[model samples]
Target: MPSATYASRRSELETYFDRTAVEAWARLTSDAPVSRIRATVRAGREAMRAELLSWLPQDLSGRRILDAGCGTGAFSLEAARRGAEVVAVDVSPTLIGLARARAADPGLPGRLDFRVGDMLDAALGRFDHVVAMDSLIHYRSGDIVRALAQLAARTDRSLLFTVAPRTPLLTLMHAVGRLFPRGDRAPAIEPVAEGSLRRRIAREAALAPLAVARSRRIARGFYLSQALELARR
Candidate 1:
C-alpha cells in the first residue's frame, strides 16, 4: 500500500504535469530533425543515460523493458529506437497522453506502450530492465526502501534510478528555499544520504553498484546523483 504522503505528493505532481504538458510538448518538438530534438532532450538526461546503460546487459536487442515514472517517454523512446520493446508508465495521465501522441505522430505507436500507473502497483509484470530516473526523490525517507524493493521485484535484470544527494549544504539550501513563498521558488524535495540509500538497497537484497554520475551540468544548480544497481536476484 502506498503511504498517504506518497499518494498526496503523486497527486500534486500529476496536477503540475497536466498543466505543463502542452508547453513541454511544444518545447520538445521545436527542434528540426526528430533525432536532433531527441538528443537535445536527452542532454538533460545524460546522467540517467550513463548510469542506466552501465547496469544493462551489453545486448538489449529484442528484450522487453519497463520504464517506471517515464515522464514524457524520453528514455522509453530511446530504448524502443534501440530495438527493445518498451512499456513506459507514469502516475501522470497528461504526460502519458503526450508520449502516446508523440509516438503516434512518428508512426511508432506499435513500438511503445505508455500507461498511467503507480510504481508501487505490482500488476505491471517483470521485465529484463526497469528504470526510474529522477522519480524516487518524491518519496519521503522510509518509502524509498519499499520503492526500491518493489522496483527490484519487477525486474529480472537491473534497476536504475537517480536521487538528489543529501549533503549538509544541500539540506540547508532546501530548508531555506521552503521558508519562502511557493511562487518565488520551487520546493526542493529532501534528499536521502548516500549511506542511508545504500542501506535501503541492501535491505532489498545485495545490489552491486554499477555507476554513479553527477547531474549538475544538465540542470542548473541541481545537485543530483544517478545510480545503477544490478539486482542480486
Candidate 2:
C-alpha cells in the first residue's frame, strides 16, 4: 500500500542506483594503496552487526527475514548465517550482485537471496524480522511515513534501523556543506530527527519504540543512531 508519490520516488532512487552502483562498488573494491574504503565498510558493518545481534530475539532458527536496502549484504548475510530464510533487496544492481557473489562463497551459499528492487515495491512476503540500516535517510521528509508503512507491511515481528540524529548543528552542517564547492561528497550530510521520525513510523505502522541508542561515530565521518522497534500488528 504505497502511495503514488512513494512509488515515483522509489523509481527515481532505483534509476540513480542503476547508474551509479557499479562504479560505487568498483571504488569500494579498488586497489589503490591509500584507500581505506573496504576497511571502513567492514568496520561500519561490524558495529551495526553488534547492535542488531544484541537486540534480536534468540531462537530465530528457520525464521523468515527481509533485509531492505541491504547494501553489500552485511545484515542480510548475518541473518542467513543465523538460519533465517533471507531475502535481501536493494535498488542497486551492483550491490545486489556483490551480495549474490558473497552468498556464493563456500560458507554462505544457498543461504541468502539477493535481488535488485525497491523496498517499496518488492513482494517480500511475511518476514519475522526486517532490517534497514542506514538506509532510510535517502527518503525525502514527506516520504518517510510511506516508506515505514511499506517496510512494516513486509514483516510481522520486528524492524531495526539507524538514522542520523536530527540536531540543529547537524542540519546546519549539511546545509553549509551542500553549498560548498568541494563538500558535495561529504559523508555527514544526511540526518533525520528522532521525534519526527517516530511520529511518521507511528502513523504508517502499528509500532512500539523499543530502544534508542545514543549516536555512535563509527568511521572517519559517519555517525549513526540505532533504533529497535517492534511491529505491533
Candidate 3:
C-alpha cells in the first residue's frame, strides 16, 4: 500500500502533468523548438534513456517490461521495437493520451500497452524488467524507497529508476526554479544523497531480495539525475 505522503505526491504530480504542464511537456518531448534550458533537459533525458536501454539485453523477445511513468512513450516504443512486451503507464491522462497518439506508428511491434494509472498498481502485473525514468524525483526519500519496494515485489529480474541526486548544482537549480512564475514551475524535486539512498535501500526489508546492480549519473546544463539498477538475486 502507498503511504499518505506517497499518495499525496502522486496526486500533485497528476495535477501538474495533466493540467499544468500538458502542452509544455508535449513540446518538450517533440522535435519542435524549445528554449535552451528545455533543450538541455531533452538532451539529458535522451542520454539517460539510451544509458538505461544499453543496460538491457539487445534481444528482448518474449520479455515483459514496464515503462513506469512513461511520458510520451518514446522509451516504450523503442523497447517494443526490440520485441519486449512493454506496458507504458503514467498518472496523467493527458500525457498518456499524447503517448497513445504518438504510438500510432504502425511500424512498431504489437506489444506496447499504454495506460493511465499508478505505476505501482498490481493490476499492471509482474514484469521481467521495469524502467522508471525521471519519475521518482518529486517524492521524499522514504516514499521513494517504499515505491521501489512495491516495484521490487512485482519485478522478476530488474528494476531501473532515476532520482534527483543531491548535488550543489541541483540545489542551486531548485532555488532558481522557485524564482520562476508559480504557473510555469514544475513541482519541487526532492534531491537525495546517493550514499544515503543506497544505505536506505540496503536496510529496507521489503527490498532484501534485490541488490543494487549498477548506477550512473546524467548531468547536462539544467538536467541532473541518477539512474540506479536493482537486480533480483
Q: What is the TM-score of each candidate against the true structure?
A: 0.77, 0.76, 0.95
lDDT of 3 by residue, 1-233 (tens): 99999998899899999998899899999999999999999999999999999999988999999999998999998898888999999999999999999888778654889999999999999999999999999998999999999998889999999999998878888889889996777788999999999999999999999999999999988888999999988
Off by over 4 Å in 1: 20-44, 105-110, 182-187, 204-223
**What are the per-model C-alpha RMSD values against the true structure?**
5.0, 4.1, 1.5
Error of 2 at 187 (Å): 11
Q: Could you say which candidate leads in lDDT?
A: 3
Candidate achieving higher lDDT, 1 or 3:
3
- Each candidate's number of clashing pairs is 0, 0, 0
lDDT of candidate 3 at residue 34, scale 0 to 100 = 100
Better of 1 and 2 by lDDT: 1
True-vs-predicted CA distance for residue 80, candidate 2, Å: 0.8
- Pick by TM-score: which candidate is best? 3
Evaluate model 2: give its TM-score. Answer: 0.76
Q: What is the C-alpha lDDT of each candidate?
A: 0.66, 0.63, 0.93
How high is the lDDT of residue 42 in model 3? 94
- Cα lDDT tens digits, model 1, 48-125, are 565576556555676788888887777787777666778899887877877777666364432687889886678878
